[model samples]
Target: MCSVTLRPALPADLDALSALEQRCFDSDRLSRRSFKKWIKRQHDGLIVAETPERELAGYALVLLQPGTRLARLYSIAVDPSRRGQKLGEQLMDAAEDYAHEERRLYLRLEVRKDNAGAIALYEKRGYRLFGLTPDYYEDHEDALRYQKRLHYQPADAARLHLPWVQQSTPFTCGPACLLMALAALKKQTPNTTEELLLWREATTIFMTAGHGGCHPMGLAIAAKQRGLSAAVWSNQKGALFVDSVRDPDKKAVICALHEHFVKTCRQESIAVHYQDFTATDLDRAISNGKIVLVLISTWRLDGRKAPHWVAISGSDEECFYIHDPDPGEDQAPLDCQHVPITREKFEQMRKYGQAKLRTAVVLGA
Candidate 1:
């Protein structure tokens, strides 16, 4: 090692950084324009490594998520000649330090699964693999997502704890999520008995696959029947899943269920709110000590357009803490039950249905 130096990146370093990326990787490299953008926009500066002679050795770009304590190590690269000198580790450490200083609760990154050396280095630095994304790279290779929990704030005050349960059947995600929300708010852990009963009470006649999904109004009715207060906010007025069913007979049945739900909601006086729901609404609910069951497309979780549900447990400006009732292989290791999704992405992911519905049901004590 010949006296290396670590420092913040500059707009002047853009060309050198791009050249260094090309030296280290065969594909999926960020362009010089991207590097320049990060230099200008990243809250935490684009970090870099330089030799005593001021030659570029390596660099890393980190992203600080707003409204919450989370950050991401978006990109990192080292000069090929400096590979064995621990330059990558140095850059990684620097990036994490910057994120921690910014009050982030955790730092996350994704790497190719086949890159054993990088995996080992990250694991050694206290990073644990939490998610797996299929074909994440341009070359169609799998990527392992890792997260290292960062310490910040009061422990109990910072997190909203909810009892977690995985869905028993493929189509019962809606009921499972509602069960988790009810149990969390009631402050008691209930088994899948309520989950099954809610499914029976709320399931539409047909969905995108076998069995059916629970309608927003149906869910409210189920909760109301159980002596719990429920509210519904929807983008569409008619029955929800009916539009997805191709069979005329099945669609009719779904329509009947929808009619029954709306009638029951009116009879029980369960207020049905209407709007393009936002995370702020959920955050206020969480702050008021309420629980929420929300619908989202499973496509963001796995590349599939399946309907899914999650229980909102906690919220802040930057993220929504969710208790996902159906954690797939990619989500289980990540403790999807208490997962923190950035507010922006959560708002987008909550949009499902053909109408891009962003609706939620707040279950009360």
Candidate 2:
């Protein structure tokens, strides 16, 4: 057995890294250009294991997703001669450590489905299977997706375990959240068609771009239509999102939709409060067996200054658990499920736009 040292891959090691990639993989090998690019990239980590003789023994590459707390183990390879010495495990450990140091909450990877040895190694290292993709490789092999949570918390049995439903489109986050809440309360399964229908029923008709987002009042009305008792809490009394719209025609349409939603809430006898839904209110609602959907700005979560919606699944003294509807492309669905946000941060995230509007809808049986 030979001793090996793990260190960051340097430009000098690019040829060795490229050769190691070729020796390790038959079909999906990283090109020399790719190796050079990653070696110089600041946001990614490329680590190499070298012997005292300056020979490369193994290497691992981890890619970080900006605007998300996720890092991916994009590639790892160990020289065939060094197999029995547990270099693979060492590389895995290094990948995880790098991700944790970068403040990533989870690390994910994809391995070939037929790779029994690799799968066993990952499972032994606490990576759980989350999903699968067909034809994920150049050779037409299926891929097994796995993820490991870097930080773990004890499960709160009292917390509402609401079902998670990802938004189908960019603008349907509110409706996706509403569907999750409805699913939890009614024990019904939600689908994309129903998600779009809810979006159609709740959308405010115009926004900063593309399709409009759902309003709190509109979401409350949609919830009521689904046979749930709904109540809305908002800090603003004036029409929502009107100030954000520049075009007079779009503003008029938004105002009209807001008025209609308000009228529908009154006609359906749903409660509407012109006030902020505090953290105390959130915990109280969950304590009494109700589902709450709150509006939040995405700037804190994804570096995007856009209004988004998420469902409050549970609460603790220190944090509020949320199910974000849009997990983005680089994130696994599990990453967005029951995400814990601290009380102080939650306060900052719950407001949106220049008006700093805060809105929430509480749904009950």
Candidate 3:
């Protein structure tokens, strides 16, 4: 592996950066004029990596947009010789870190729809496909628009979306909302060993079937309830559902709480993730030996507080505990309770929540 030093780009580095871009890209080549345009864009930055001999191995260019806290990947290129050495990943990491450090809410980029390799890399890094822009490039090629969330905390996610969370806007809904959510969980709360099985089954069914109710939360909640620490690596940010009273971004923030818990834990706990969600990133975080939490809240109806929060615990013929956050603060255990939902119910609920957004959780390896 080549050990490259990451540093800010200088005027002298422009030639190298431009050359790298020219070598890596075709059809939509950026000329000298365009390079100047890039340099003049404020809220934008450029970074480059060098060998001990001061050779440019790779470069990344980013531009910031107004009104939205999003940074665009204007360009990135790696030397042909360094292509398979993961230099692209390094450049992406450097660019994304800089964007986040500057308090950008999300990283947005457009990749050629046919660029499978680049798509795989970005998707593996937790970038979610939002839409496609037709005839976006100079050659009229359609571009895949992706968004990667930077907020790592639920509070941060919520604060970003609903500033009121930090502005003290006051949750006027009061305990009623909390009670209803709690009551939903209480219906399946298990007390006895047999009841535990029943509760777990029911909750699992509800969660795997919904948006955020992925099973990773269940395992962590179970571990926390047992006084054991739990950790889960998360990929997606922002909630699958939207609330008229709250910001949709609140969902991503709330879901990230599980990642926060998993990080603070001391045990080699579970890592949760979904099929389409970022798996390699979560796998790297777990290294191995972590539970998988499937986010199932995607089925929530529009404008509903997506019943999107759930953790999947262990499974057996008897039951599986799905960690659910809709239970509200009132019924939320000192740790958390394991609720049971049936497999049939779980699939049914998934069909319901499939319309919303969702992602999985795992421990960072």
Task: List all candidate RMSDs to the true structure.
Answer: 9.8, 4.1, 19.2
Model 1's lDDT to the true fold? 0.77
Clashes (N, CA, C under 3 Å) per candidate: 2, 0, 58
RMSD of 1: 9.8
Candidate 2 C-alpha lDDT tens digits along 1-365: 44888889888898888888888888989899888877777434788999999999999889776544567898899999899888899989889999999887668888999999999999998888866768889999999978877776345422636888899898999999988988888977888998899889999989988899998988988898888899999999989987777999999999999999989999999999999898888888998899999999989887888999999888766567788888786566756765757577789888899999999999997
Per-candidate TM-scores read: 0.61, 0.77, 0.41
In model 1, which runs have C-alpha deviations exceeding 4 angstroms? 1-158
Q: Pick by TM-score: which candidate is best? A: 2
In candidate 1, what are the lDDT values of residues 189-267, reduced to their tens digit? 6677777888999888588678888888888888888777899988777667655678888888888888888888999
Task: Order the candidate numbers by lDDT, best to worst.
Answer: 2, 1, 3
Deviation of model 2 at 182, angstroms? 4.1
Instruction: Give candidate 1's error at residue 25 in angstroms.
Output: 34
Candidate scoring better on lDDT of 1 and 3: 1
Go through the candidates in order and give each one's C-alpha lDDT.
0.77, 0.85, 0.50
